[model samples]
Target: MTPGTRKSALLAGTILSLSMLAGVASAETTVTMWTFLDPNKTSPREVALKQMIADFEAANPDIKVKVEPQDFAQMPTKFFLGHQTGGNPDIVWIDAKNLSGLDTSGAGANLDELLINQWPQEDKDDYYAKASFDAAMFGGVHTALPLFNGGSMIYYRKDLLKEAGIDPASLTTWDAILEAAKKLTKDNDNDGRVDVWGFGMPLAPLKTESSPVYISLLEQPAALYTGECEIKLSSDLGVKGITYTADLITKHKVTPQDALVINVDDVTDQFIAGRYAISIGSMLRYSVIKGKAAFGADNFDIIKWPSWTGEKPGATPLSGWWVAAWKNSPHLPEAGKFLNYMLGKEGVGLWTTVGGQVPTRKSVLESPDFAGPQYDWVRLMVDAWGQTGYMDPPSCNTRTLQGALNEATARVVLDNLDPVEALKEAEAKFADAQ
Candidate 1:
């Protein structure tokens, strides 16, 4: 071949290569996500998320996800604050308690409009339940997708209940629970002191444990929300719930009196030490209790909250981090696609199998991956989500609400204040906080 022809062909090849690279770069889109978890971290959730992101990227080479880790408690507040400066993230992770505030902020995107409008009802029905989507729904629109599921339940000694001839199902009512507690409470050495308190509940306002317990075990606190940020917990129904909780420590003597000062951590310690038959706790603590229990790890299992009547189980506060997109994000379409990918059946299924989270999809929960004895806790939690009611977080100050309730409980059980009086004080404090 002639030198001139060879040189012309080489020049044309170089130009074509440069043009292709430019096309690829121009088509690529980057989506930024804000979360408390660093994908580089080795935690199970982080690891699973990291792998999921990598998988998404591999499947869609035109898009890249940029994760920006933020402090969890501050993420929600910071997200709104950033909106003021026009520097909001493309996507954000929000805690459930603060989710109501998201609607008023006007920064959250309408996920139903962006993603779910075209989805068939069969696909929509695949979600765990109405609450699964309702938690993210605001003013008749979905603003986010539930990323994980968490709820508090009573962790009990399986062996102790069997020895006492108490079927866990029989303790479905508070009255039945009280009777079972009476039987379970005993002194092993014939001492006049109880070696095992039938139940342990953390009532200290200084700790957040008791407040979660109070919310998880009943729906009244959420029911009292006036929709205008006012909570009338001083009402007759509210007073009744508080009275029952206090009587367990003050009158029935089934729960340890020391619960007034101890938190859930302390209660958990006492439980593992075999000084309590049942305690208010979380699934996150299940593995720890199982590994550390003095009596036997296999003896520990969970029970859903009992109701005032045996008609229904008390609501569990079933919420975890939620995934949302900025309403005015420049990359709204791309962000919506990423959110769908992250929350899709395969994605959440991978999360349950690898991240060790409770699956949020009914199909995933029933899948073969969840089979076997090791996943009994997962099944129990699935029932907790399916069979019982759930606590709805208020749009107002959740911490303040919890504080007021905790203080009211402390006053009744510790200072001997009247339940109505304490409830009134709580109502005033909560009103002032809002």
Candidate 2:
């Protein structure tokens, strides 16, 4: 054969190989995920999540993740309904309150069968939030992997505490914090209106399902719900939690009256604007709050929830978001790979450093990355999750429960109803939901 003929044959072979490679790439599986966060956005958490997905794609050339951002409050209802109608995405983000119907409806697949979820006992034990994982399980099968496991705690100004000579340790109980708030509330310019209030927390469920402050207090936590899934908000602890939240507005005046209509995000903004010396905020707000703290991010740190009875630390609701697979997705395995990658060591590690989340991994939280004063709040939260935290029992009707509890707070704070009577009304409303 001629040398020119041999060259043409080699070129043909290379062209065929390129075509086959492109075909293989085109056949890659796409795993669709429904979450509240838009990875395309510029927020820190969103940017981190986007980076995580990019890294996962780089690692696994055969799988692709398509993130569908939804309103977080709408995820549960939309997902459950989608499951019923065969229109759900391959994966979904399940918040704590909506975990009840997951297993029963088979909307969430048994994640235990996933290879990544079958971690070694040591790897499993390394996860700090065990209850979070347990909360995702139903009927002896794991339904989801707990991705962002965190709870509410007090974010306070270190500078304010030091200036007022208020020892941080002494503010261990709710009552003590109230006293400190009163001392901190002052008008530096001698005006009738106070400039810097002592505390700020959002009690209105006007925007969302319920108030996180009220949840941490009333659910104060597992004790609030009885055997029949009936919430006993009228209990002593419940009444106490209720009265404490209301009195802060009406009696103590540490928190502004306008707080009655705002949500946690609104109050976080107020605290960042330097309106409050201390505020009740979710652990998820750590990075955002840290960035905007007028007193300096390092000067701002979270403390453990002040104990109600002072016997133990207050309840940290086993709250936060979860990543679960759809039972009917044709791409279930690929979905698990994406979910596991996002929740694994590298991904979960980024949650602390990049996303500002209190991840479920202990080693990630305890690492050198999380060391020092800025991350001390992370330690306090870890302690609470490991020791005193509790999640509410699974209930199909959490929206109603939250709505009822919100009315209870609104009536007490706005209408001046007795705390006991307010809570009794809350229980009655919760019962009506059943």
Candidate 3:
């Protein structure tokens, strides 16, 4: 062949080789995820997720994960808008409270079938029988898989309790709790200002922190909601529950004058500053309590909520982040694999140890590390989880219902509105939502 012909043949071979390499590159699957966990931050959750992602890629070399972290408050709206506009991610981290609403809005791909069709029975056994698996199902359709389960606990200063001549062990009823609170409340420096309030109650207009506590106070809070999702916040029992809690601020004056404006963060900050003897919040606060507050397990501790006479103490309902695949995701298979990896033994192990989440699996929870001294407080949480009561009304409009409850609670505590009147307003709003 002539020189020109040989040069043309070489160019054609080069083109063919380049096309083959491009095909190989395109064969790799990419799964996009949207989450509130900021990978740039060195928080435990972020670190665990990064580790999980690295492990996932190592195991599945053909798949790649792309994480897009956004603000936690903005997630629900952004996910809803993305679903509406057809520009959604492959996977989303859903707030447990919003799972039903998002599932109803077509954001979640039905994962119930995966339990039967895709997942092996042995693999499924690792998850909690009802709390982890069934809790994710909305109307029998599995909307998501729990990233981890968490609930609030009341944290008390054991040192303060002893100083006030109150025994925490003897306080298992509302009456005893109130009496202890009275003792705990005092003006330490003789400045005529109450430096330490007995209890820190969250009553902010936007935060529904009081809702869980109020529910725990009820014998059966679910009785406040009908089968048709009609809220009966003005029921006699409901009134009594709200009245007793509101009295902590109004009648008893154990909480601050502006407790009506305090949210979870405010209460936590105050608790750390030694301004409150007792406060309620999530298990995530344990890190702060142990590290920043410099409080030993003896100085501070958590307990199940006090109950009415002859009733069992109640625990907060399951509340945490859940992961779900979007129905519109083009990479469903890859997304499913990623989710499975995150929920598997290795993923959950890293999360519990590093991410500081309560275990969703009984077996994992029973592990020796969880029973170790470092995580002894988790035993109380596990006990609480076992006895947790359901507070959320099963409705797609739960946010509306919760907002109504929050508004009514604020009115009763701040404006001194009658419990019946405040709750009637809340009932009207919930009925309107339905």
Q: List the global CA lDDT of all models.
A: 0.78, 0.79, 0.74
Candidate 1 has its poorest 10 consecutive residues by lDDT at 208-217
- Per-residue error at 77 for model 3, in Å? 2.7
After aligning candidate 2 to the native by TM-score, how far in Å is the CA of 154 from where it should be? Answer: 1.0
Estimate the TM-score for candidate 2: 0.89
Q: What's each prediction's TM-score?
A: 0.79, 0.89, 0.88
| lDDT for each residue of candidate 3 in 214-239, tens digit (9 for 90 to 100) | 56434566575665776567877667
Measured with C-alpha atoms, the lDDT of residue 177 in candidate 1 is 77
List, residue by residue over 298-405, the lDDT tens digit for candidate 1: 888887777776676776667677889999899999888888888888789767776777877778888887887878888878777777646455456656665667
> lDDT for model 3, on a 0 to 1 scale?
0.74
In model 3, the number of clashes is 0
TM-score of 1: 0.79
Candidate 2 — worst ten consecutive residues by lDDT sum?
A: 207-216
Task: Give the runs in model 2 whose Cα sits over 4 Å from its true position.
Answer: 1-21, 207-223
